[model samples]
Structures are given as C-alpha cells and as structure tokens.
Target: MDRLAGTSGFGGVYGAGIARPQRGSSIVIGYESALAFWRRSRVEDPALTRELLAQLYPDDMLATLDAEALAADTSLRPLELPNSPFERIHHAALALGLREPVDIVVGKDAARRRSPSARCHVWSGPVSDGLLVGVEPGVYICSPELIVAQLASELGLYKTISLAMELCGSYSLLVNGACEYGVPSSTSHSRISSVLRLSDSFRGIDVAKQAALYSIDGSASPRETVLAVMLSLPRRLGGWGCGKPLLNAEIMLSAAAARECSRSSLRADLLFDEADLDVEYQGREWHTKPEDRTSDEARQNALMMMGKSCLFISREQISDEARMDGIALLIRSRLGLRPYRRPLSTGMSLRRHQMMLDFGLA
Candidate 1:
C-alpha cells in the first residue's frame, strides 16, 4: 500500500483499488456514488480499494498488455449483468440488507432502458481516459477529477472550487452505510484523486479546470475553505484579494516560543508566510471553556513574542460585512498592501454578499 501511495502514475483509481478487467466484470459505482466512495475512502481501508481492484482487473491481463497499455484499455469491461446495472445493484443491496440508492455509470453507447428500480440514478456518458477505476473485476468508479468534472456543469464556479476543497479537505463526509437485520458495517477508505490531476481539455472539466487553478490544498473544514476562497479571489468577484494563504500549514516553533506555549509547533488555519501572519478560523467546533481561552492566549502570546501577527475570526465576524472588512483591512495593513478605497460596483457588492452566504456552513 505504501508502494501504491508512493507511485505517481497510478492516480486515484489505485487509491480506490482499480483492478484489471476479467470476463464478467461490471462497472458499478459512479457519480455521487463515486464521490461518496472518495469521501468514504478517507476513513475506509486502502485494502478494500486494493482488493476491489484485484477483483476487477485480472493479473493475467498484464501478461499480454504492458502496465500503461492495460490501464488504458476499457474495452474489456462488460455490461452490468447482461442488462440492468441498477436492478443488479438493488438486488445485491437487498441481499446485503442495504437500502441506499445506487448510482451506475455506463459508456455513452451502452444500452440502458428508460429507467431501472426506484433507488437508482443512471448516468450515461463518454468517460475520459483516466475516468474509470476498477475495484472489482470489470467493476469501476469514476475518478475524483472526473467526479468534479462531472459536477462542474452543475456546480458553476465558486461551488466547484468549494467541492475541490472539500474533496481534498481534512474532514470526510463520513457516511455510516450499515443497515439491515444483522449486517455489520464500519467506516473507512482512501485518497485517490486531487485537484492537481485536473485536465484542461477533458470533456466535462472546462469549469473544474478554472476552479482547480484557485484551489489550494490542506483545508481542514468547509469554513476554512470558504475563508480561503473568499480572501483569495479577486475583488471583482466579491473577495478581498488577499491571495491564497497556506491552509492548515504547520509552523515549527523556536525553543523559547515552544516553552511558553507548551508546544513545539503550531498549525495555523490560514498562514500568510511572507507577512509572518496567521489567521485562525475559530468555528463552533472549538471549545469555549476558560481553560481553552487561557491556552489560546498563551499561544497568541507566543506568536506575539515571535513577532508574528495572528488574527482570530469567528463565524459571527465572517457573516458581518463591516467586521469582515475590518479584519481584511488589518490583514492588508500587516501585509503592507494598500486597502481598497473605492466602493465595489453594485453587481460586485451583490456577488460578494452572495458568496458570503453561498457556502453551506451548516
């Protein structure tokens, strides 16, 4: 698994456990299911992905096809059990005592009826070169990039960027899929795709490519992602134009600072390295006890001693335009950048206001 993670060539399919296609393999999971697989993978076992991949792709396929060529070949993939992928999955779920809707993807030309069972969402399309990742022999899921690309048409710009952040963010959506009489289930999975793998010319990735350009890595939560996007985007689109900061970047502390703060290092929610400043997004997740405040003060004192400025922003301040602007002013002052004096255009003001409320903090 370490070797698998270490390899740069395999991409997210390997993370989801792509296997070589065999005689009766079916392409089962895709779309929301594929997205769900990635979010679930962060907590699930890499072994699951691995085993599924092994099941999908027969090892013997490599004997004739080179590794690269084998990965590129999607022709060996089979239809979903002679006819209906949706019904096939529904029956399997019933056997397993599960009841969630199953999403199935098929090639653009694959034969599918008008509909399937009540619990299926069918998507037919021409998948990109690296889209399908086999987990069980012939079974596949859309890659993370492909999933985002699929979503781009629906998500627009800001939402697409937010999706990118969430996909690569610290917290997983964490679905507990266990259901039924006595079937045992647990949570787990792996990281198989990233924004870096986004393609410019991919069929459905036109908007996602732009989102990827603004997307940064290592966001801890949705709030942090909102802050990053809000502060990093250009002013014309309702942002402070603070430029992208390092989200959840670790900063090693000096012995003196560590001694005072009682820690050797600190992980800032957002860090502007050039300005020697750190912005902390103190959302509802943080405990508000007196001791927590005391500890936070100590850390702040440590940063002050180190000659680094730290600004704390809460959800309340984030929602208030005046308060957020004050914070931005303070940040720009510290960054040695000029603040905007001219008022935003009416359209820009509306866009900015909408952006603040757009992110689903809940």
Candidate 2:
C-alpha cells in the first residue's frame, strides 16, 4: 500500500499507476536513447552525474550513491551502453563491493525451459557497483542493482493487477458457471481456455467503442469474463510487457502478492533470517537478526542505507544493525554478489564450480 517513488526500497504498489508514457513522449527506461548523451562527455563531470542521479533516483538515495566516493575513485569511468540505467548502477555497485556481478542474459527462456522466463544465469565475480547519471532527457547511467530491484518491485504491481483481474473474472465466471440449466455446472471450467484465447486475440483489436457491449457479453460467460480480464491487462500494464511472456508476468505478480501477504504472518522470533533473501557478499554473510536498538530513527537509517523506502517489520521494532544487514543482504541479493553454490546437499565443491564462480566468490 505504501508507494515510495524514487526511493531504492520499494517502487510502491503498481508503479504509481502511471501510464507508460507514449514511446516518444518523454523517455523510456531501458531504451538506448536514455543514455545517449553520456558518450559525449569524456570526463563525465561529477556535477553532471549528480544531476542525473537526482532525476533517476529518489532524493533519499543521493547519499548512498556516494557521489564523494565515486569522485574519489578516479579509475571509474562512464559504463558502455546497449545497457540500461539500472544496469550501470549494478556495475558500479559491483566495483564498490556493494554487490556481486551477475550475468543477465535475455533469451527465449532464461532458465532454458520451454516457458518464456527472464533467465538469470548468475555468474560469480567481483561485486560491481555504479552510480546513475543522466546524459540527457532520454539517457541515464544504468544501475544494474536498481534495475533488478525495479523489476523485483514490479512483482508487487503485477499482483495487484492480477488479483483485481481475478476477482472480476471470477465474479463473472461464477455467473457464467451457473448459466447452464439454471444451475452452476463444472463444464463452465472449459470456457476459461476459450476466454483466455479470445482475450489474447482481443489485444490485437481495438475495443474502445464496444466497451458497453462487451461488458454485457462478458457477464454472460466465465470465458467471456476471463477474456475480458486478459484484454483489460494491457491497459493496466502499458502494452504487453515488452518481450516477456504472459506467464512471466503472471508469476511476477503472484510472487509480489505472496510477499506482501506474508508480511504480517512472520513469526516474532523470525528476523532477517532468509537464506536466499539474506545473502553473503564479499566474503561476509550479513547477520540475520534485526538490530537490538529498535526505534523509528533506526528504521529510517536502515531504509536510507538499504536504499529502500518501505519496511515489513516484525513484532519487535527494527534496529540499526538489522537495517544495515538488511541493506547489505538486499544489495547482495539484487546484485548476485553472494557465493554461487550448488545446493549444499548436492555436494559440489567451490573448485568444481565454473571459473566465473571463483571470480564472484568474494
């Protein structure tokens, strides 16, 4: 429910509910044009970089970018493109030991499965990190960590869309289910597939003028309702989610909703103890317990360090140490900085891991 815009923590519920501004309207997030201006500046002035960060990140995130630290590290230069602002931040973070460098490939199926999934073939390498800088209106330095986080945050937004769609679709389906013989019949379930297909087809057509008529039809059958729900998704998500498959969006939405749903269900003794969620980076695994000193000030500090604007706390208030660990864990997880290990039970040693594995083990 908390919509923290520009903050590194939470991207908020459903991406500010803002329409994906038209293609040429302002500037798209992942397009090449977004960082085109960076090619012009040889030194890439610090002030210019700071301004770009201001435009791309929330004001609360400025300190974490470590403008001063970046300026001091003269070896760093503007990252090459064909990437995104989020990617650039990720590289910088890796270099700064803020996160692990991960190899992100966009393929038909990232996991090599039949389904269309954004495959994340994480390679272990030195943690890399970078700052977000705006080169021009359409261009900005790519922060890989931020981009991953942004994508992760989308899971929540997509959930809202799906649930809303499901509720509406289910309501109409219930009616259609009962339309048979004046009583609900199991045969109505078969209509779901037909409706899904119809919805997919409808996406290609314009139904602006037929809204009312379609609404009436949709109420007649669960299939029509399901189709209506699918058809309505593009409007909320802003044009079919790029190259990603429909199922990927479904999964992302489900994950986000699941996390939010579990927030209040966490046990009092359970702090930041998730193994996958609480990770190790740069040879150190951040502590899993919440900081002992709990207070609003500690929570704010943790949020600041973690670059997150949202918090899902347990019965005991979060402390500074807990916040710090949370931030480190988040950075590591987002950047893929943690040790790349096969499941411990699998019995694979680090030496057997790929070369890239050792490179990222630190």
Candidate 3:
C-alpha cells in the first residue's frame, strides 16, 4: 500500500499539504487581542475549537480551521467524531499487534481471487466485505465506504462507486486480543457481503423501448426507473440531470418545486418550526403546508406523480397535451403499473429514520 497525497481534515495524515512560512515573511502577532482570549480557555480539541469559532462568528467560520494544528495534535486521532461512520476497528487490531498475512489487490477479481499470498482484497469500489479504508497501509481515519455514503447523502442519492483500489489486507487486522498471522479466524468464506448479477436484459434498446420498460407501472422503484431511463440514454444526454444516475429524480423535481416555492414567497413557520433554524429561503413567506394525511396515502400519491412524470419525460419530449392526458392514461395503464405497488403491499415505508439522538432528528 502506497501513502496517499495529503490528509488535513480526512484520513490519518494531517499536515502533509501545508506551506512553511519563509524567514523574510512578515509575521503578524496580535497577542493582546487574539492570544489573550485563547489563553483564557486554552482549548485543545479541534471540534471544540471549531464549535467556539462557529459560535463567535456565526457566519462563514468554517474556513478558519488550522490544518497545521490539526495534523500535529497528538491527542486527536482519525475518525474520532460520532458524526463519522468510521469505526475504531484498526485501533482494536493495533492493540492485538498480531503479525497477520496482509494481501492487497486492485479490483473485484483480486478480491475474490484465491492465492497463497492473498489474505485481503483491496477492492477499489465502495463495496466493503467488512471494513474498508485507504490504499495506504498506515492509519486511516475514514473508509471509502463511509466517504461514499456521506457523499450520497449530501447529494440526496443512494449510491456511488469509485475506480481506485486501496490496500485490502486479507484477514481481520485483529484476532481476539492480538494481531494473528494470515486471515483472521473470524473471517470465513461465509462472510461474503456483496454479489453481482448479470443478465441479457441489459442489452441495446431504443429510446421508446427503454422508456416503455422504465414506465411500466410500479415494476420498480421510482429512483430505479429514473436511473434505468438515464442509463439508457447516451452519456451526453444523461449529463442533463445529476451526474450520478443512482440519485433520485426527486432531487431535480424538488429543485423545481423549491424554485416555485421561492417565487411564491413561502413562509418557514407555515411548513416547519423555526425555533433553532439559522437559515431560511428568501421570498418563501407565502407557502402552504400540505394538509395532514395518512403516510401511506401521501407516499402513494407522491410515487404516482413522480413515476408518471418520469415516465412521461422518459418516453417522449414533454408536451402540453401529455400533461392533460394524465388522468385518462392513468386509468388505461393501471394494469401495466400494477407491479410498482407491490412494495406498498409488503408494508415497507420509504421515509428515512434518524439513527442517533445527537443528530437533532430524535
């Protein structure tokens, strides 16, 4: 495993990219104004310092983080924050200190490949057999899987993949209380996590057929259908939407709705409580919250509307008549769309639930 470039706020290495000050450079020291306040508190934690700065500034203070201090601080370690998903599994391994066989490979082939020298597969993609991290052998604060999940959530998407492979040492780095040689006793063939499916249905198809397949009533998830429709088009054509096809079409549709909401001067209090919120959209004082309804009904309506719109856009270029024909066509196409409603019948709900109490959702 090779050492990656820089790691200031991510992974383990912190200060690799900072530039040193020259001897002739002017050094501005305002000890009376700046040092006096810091000395009164003398805080060491980066997150605490960031919190204080955000509190004091209350406006664009995120740029003030000192990468130099962040890297050199011994008390701090990689992925220490609760908000991050990276677990302290390596720390547990290091504590074990067993000399295990470490095998690193590039792709799925290398991951699944069986060889005498192999112990782990350094798969470059987001899929992780157990825990995944950097290609380098040293301490990593975050894994690629965690990073990908964060990116997907921020982008309001479900999944994303990478091409680069990292160090995938075979065997769990920790065995019981010590680092053992070769694969960890716990790692077994039964521990396989992800599997790929291949089929002939993914072959060449024209726009109409592609649209028809995706438009078939309730056969797949709205996001799935949208992604299928997007992938069916050429790269250039697909570029019109978000970069990742796995992202829900709602991201685009919601943006349009947001624009409409903004134009209509909606109000925050009408939709959500504004007690602790620090930000609000401009000219949004005229909006009306949707009437309270059963969750199932609301979800069904949303899915129907989203699916209908996505299929309409996918099948042909948008038209005024297409909008008007929705009701009549919906009745006639009820049978075709029957498959899409199966998930609802199974009693599964799509709304996301917050995991921890600290996130504020609880």
Could you give the C-alpha RMSD of every candidate to the true structure, in order shown?
6.9, 24.5, 20.5
Best by TM-score: 1
| Residue 252, model 1: Cα distance from true site in angstroms | 1.0
Better of 1 and 3 by TM-score: 1
What is the full ranking by lDDT, best candidate first? 1, 2, 3
For candidate 3, the per-residue lDDT at 177 reads: 28
lDDT (10s digit) by residue, model 3, range 1-362: 11122322322222232222222211111111112222221122334322222211111111232333223321222212122112222332333231222222223342243333223332232222112222112322122212222232222221111100000111111223232222211111111111111111211212212222222111112222232322222222321111112212122224444343233222221011111111111122212333322322333334334342212221222112234134223322432322222222111212111111111122
lDDT of 2: 0.25
**TM per model?**
0.75, 0.20, 0.20
Model 2 stretches astray by more than 4 angstroms: 1-23, 27-43, 59-134, 137-144, 148-352, 355-362
For 207-234, candidate 2 gives per-residue lDDT tens digits of: 2112212221112223223222222222
Q: In terms of lDDT, which candidate is stronger, 2 or 3?
A: 2
Off by over 4 Å in 3: 1-101, 104-246, 251-296, 302-362
Query: 303 in model 1: Cα distance from truth in Å?
Result: 1.2
Which 10-residue span in candidate 3 carries the lowest summed lDDT? 161-170
Better of 1 and 2 by lDDT: 1
